[model samples]
Target: MRTSHKMDPVSLTGLGLGVISLTFQLFSGCLKAYNLLADARGMPAQFQYLRIRVRTEQHRLGNWALVANLTEQSGSLSTSLQLNEALVQEVLREQETILTSFWKVSHPHTLMIDDPKPGPVSGTEGEADLQERVPQSKSSLEDRALRFVEKMRRYPSRIRWSTFDRERLETSISQLSALNDAMMSLLDSQQQYKFHQAQIRTSMQVLHLNKKVDHLLQLFQANSMQLSMAQFSQNLRLLHSMQLSAYSSEPQEERQTLATLARFKALNVEINLDSDDERSNTSTGIFEQPPLDPRSCTIFSSVPSSYSPEEVRSDGIYENIPVWIEWKYYEPVLHIGHVDPHTQVRISRLSALLSNPQKPTQFHTPSCIGYFNDVSNYRFGLVFRRPIDVSSVGVPSSLFDLIISNEKPSLSMRVHLAHTLATAVQYLHSTDWLHKAFRSQNVVFFTNPGDTDISTPYLCGFGLSRPAQNTEMTEQPDSIPLYNLYRHPLAHSSIAVDGKSGFKKAFDVYSLGIVLLELALWMPLYRVLGVDDRNLQRSLQPGVTKKVRELLLRESRYLEMVKASAGDVFADVIRACVEGFGEEGESLHDKVVVRLETISI
Candidate 1:
């Protein structure tokens, strides 16, 4: 029986085919599972990267929209319109390219290994090939997207538009429209993929991506509106300028010019211009001309009388405005030595808001008095509302000076100062601003005529201030030792995963903590830590909390001074800040305020 059981060729072939089919099915299933796992792992990171990219793009788009609007509004559209429009089209094209690439990398085809031939056996090897290929494809896509984003960041500089070249404009528009179509297609595919994904988390991530895309679309719509407004403003300015020039050239055109001016007035357009004589004069002295009407002024040529030429520090220039300090009327004023075109626009906008009679005063920072420009330099001034002569109060120039003084401030005085400091910070936060350069030197002491319990602390030095929504991160130089001392350790360290150097509220809190520590211990940081300027700089090289703790613990005198002066609650607040508490979210500010309020003194 065994000898007669030799298998026929047909049976053997059929058996072999069945085994191959089974193996093929198993291999196919494994490949599908592998792809799913890979996607599950990779998609979240990709989405996160996409989110950052989108945010950056939104910021760039907003900036461009602002530029376009300002140019149009200022009647300079002819000079910039072509370039700006081309820029917009370029960004849109790049965005579409990124989306297309994202879709391809995120949605690879499912493996199919159903062939019954021996050639199909290579599909098993293909699985390994696919695994290797998918990652390479994803990585290449990411690299391309990143490079595109960087190119977009620098795209503004590359834009060269010639008004005579209608072909270029047409090409740009056509490219943009084609990109729009591609983006829509990619979106549709993403929607399909999202619908098919089984995991809730993955689906949610897809939903997030959809929201981001929708946001981008909304931003594009906003850009269009901004462009329109700019164009309208530009037209108005041009008409007014033309009418004025004609009126000045010919007395007979006076009536027509007046009528045109009246029409502009009816439309609420401002037509104020400097007199010819005023424009012709050239003076760069601190006080070359009388200040503008104080009531309507947003900048002044004044400062505290105590301010000396030596006290004048240059903060470089912003928008071509050379910023410096000067003395006027016994108060320290921020003096803009040159009010460039950009500065004029900002001043005009701010002046409009300040001119509103019903505007709330609580949210306002220091007020400006007036601005003037000689032929050589433009000047504007910001007057400090509260000016303190630290010398009058038996203290030095600033809170920093008081900290280093051998004389210790009373605990009650310390409490009042801390409360005032917290309140000022709370006020700034409420007004949606961050005092990025918050430090003891920035805090000035002012005594109210009748109130004598404690000197009022005013948060001055707004040179580095910015909106909370758009905080800036700056690199600290080795020469700027003050920043090194007051800045959050995380700011200098590489621990932040976000790679952000911008100041945060928590960073403000940390700076406040150091100030409080000085206030509490009644000693400068360098003195309390028993370190020289060199050691102080070195100490900041380590982690903030650990380094601070070591410095506090290493010196018994520091503990004694803090405990003896500020007590436990104040000490705890300082510790919490040093530990990086209250660094995030809206609630942290409230929490800090509550914590400060709870402190008895």
Candidate 2:
């Protein structure tokens, strides 16, 4: 006991406590990090997803960039870099398949892209807690990008909903997984275009110019993943045809395509006119979808005239409503009209001289079969008339895919789109009309090959609409649906375009700002998804919040990241569009935004 008292027990105790404290701290930190990592990896484990699909010509787009990068490294592909390229391509090919299959599955519907909209960031209170950081899990990294397959609860596609097709959803999931695999595997940069070009011009080559599938196979034989330009275009045309058949396959009188729509109308006529008091002055066989011909209706061009039209056609009425035309290439005399609006001047009734198949003497206007190129909104023409294929616009055609992939329009593109929209607004204001619904899909490019890259897109649908400028902004409060997913956010609080309501140029400009971001992003803002006037009336409801506004404000960090990568000039335009509504209004700009001089088409 005497010897122990002499010993330094206090010092020993202090040392022991310090060691325990340090150990506890280390364990606590590790546990916290592990929890965060686990939280981050909340998605399901076995779900392989597709991000997007893009078909390119490999020889036409080979490792030209990699070749350039190789030259930068040492003027040639070092043995190591070549290995890296090979490895990268292997990975890319694997991923690109994911998107390709996604396209195959969703090629029929544009509403949903594969692997889009990752689940919520924060796990709900009911979910389990993880306390240690997980290493970069292979599954997690693979899901870096989103493909946007729809929610499981909803019908996978319109067709699926109509047919109650259980297999469609399963097919969509499988196709999406395959697309995801493709996307992960395909990794060529834009510079790959050079190799592709080089492959296009081999001093001499024996091309087995047979079927399109053979051409693609030959390209594959050349050790290229990119499709030859001709094959690419041809494939697109084939995909377009498939889309058309989908429409035809849908139930008649379903109002999906014009053929069925005509059948719908014929049925309607039969219903209305087949009565005993049938004084059938009009033809009951109007607008019928026949096997011999396919007809469809879509607003080909958006006119600047606002609510009023210069002329009205048999399709609809206007004093001098500019006709909306849909073209069928096979019957160039005008069987089905093109959705492509030529310019300010839309031409319908091209072949008003053909005899109806059944009526030996009746006339019909058949669209001329040919390639029509536009020269800016200034002009356009049907340049070549080889046997052009007639494909009705498909619901989820590759055209939509192309736009989704290539619609990375620049700031200049946004400016042009915004200004053009402004011009439309100015016209609407002048006409005392309101464009109740303005969106990205509603605005598009007119292809004019001669003058510029693409002609100005016109604004079309004013149906189920409102009036702008010096008019009642809305029809009536009661008439307003409580919630419309497509309604503008401001309508949540603001009244109609009544003088005091302030739906003026500035208001339109505000709306245009949202639209500009929409087109620039090629997606709509999802934050303010109101179900009705009542839900919207609540200001901020259960799932509805104005996230886009906060995004424009830079309050959220992750979105800030998305903004940074998208580009500066483009970001500036977005900021400008979202201006004048923040706490300090830091994003607001005072520039007198230009109006489109005029839409020539």
Provide the TM-score for each candidate, comma-separated.
0.38, 0.27
Question: Which 10 successive residues of model 2 have the least lDDT summed?
Answer: 47-56
Q: Supply every candidate's count of residue pairs whose N, Cα or C atoms clash at under 3 angstroms.
A: 13, 96
In candidate 1, what are the lDDT values of residues 1-601, reduced to their tens digit? Answer: 0010112223324543221121112212222222222222122221222222233222222222332332211233234344443333333434333322222323242222122232211232212122221112222322333343332222111111111222222232233223322222222333322222211112122212221222222222222221234443543453343231111112112212222222222111111112224321222112212334433323323322121232322222223333223221121224743444434433343333232333223323333332333223323443222222332331114577555543665787787777677656654443334566677776654432233334555455554454443312222322344455666655555344124435567777777778888888776676665666555555544444336644554556665667767787677667666555543322333445445656665
Q: Encode model 2's per-residue lDDT on 1-601: one tens digit a residue.
A: 0010011223324533212221112212222222222233223322101000111112111223233332211224434435454343332333233223222344464222323334533344212211111112122211211111111012112110112222332343233223222322232443333333222222102111111222212222222222345544543453343231111211111111212222222223232222336524333332312121112212244332211122111121112322223222211224434333322111211111011132111011122221122222222222111112322221111112224445455545545655556445433332233455454434433342222222245443332233222232133211223222223445444454333654433444455666655554554443223234333445444234334454456554423533554444444554555554331111122121321212111
TM-score for model 2?
0.27
Root-mean-square deviation of Cα positions for candidate 1 versus the true structure, in angstroms: 23.3
| C-alpha lDDT of residue 483 in model 2 | 25
- What's model 1's overall lDDT? 0.38
Candidate 1 displacement at residue 392 in angstroms? 6.9
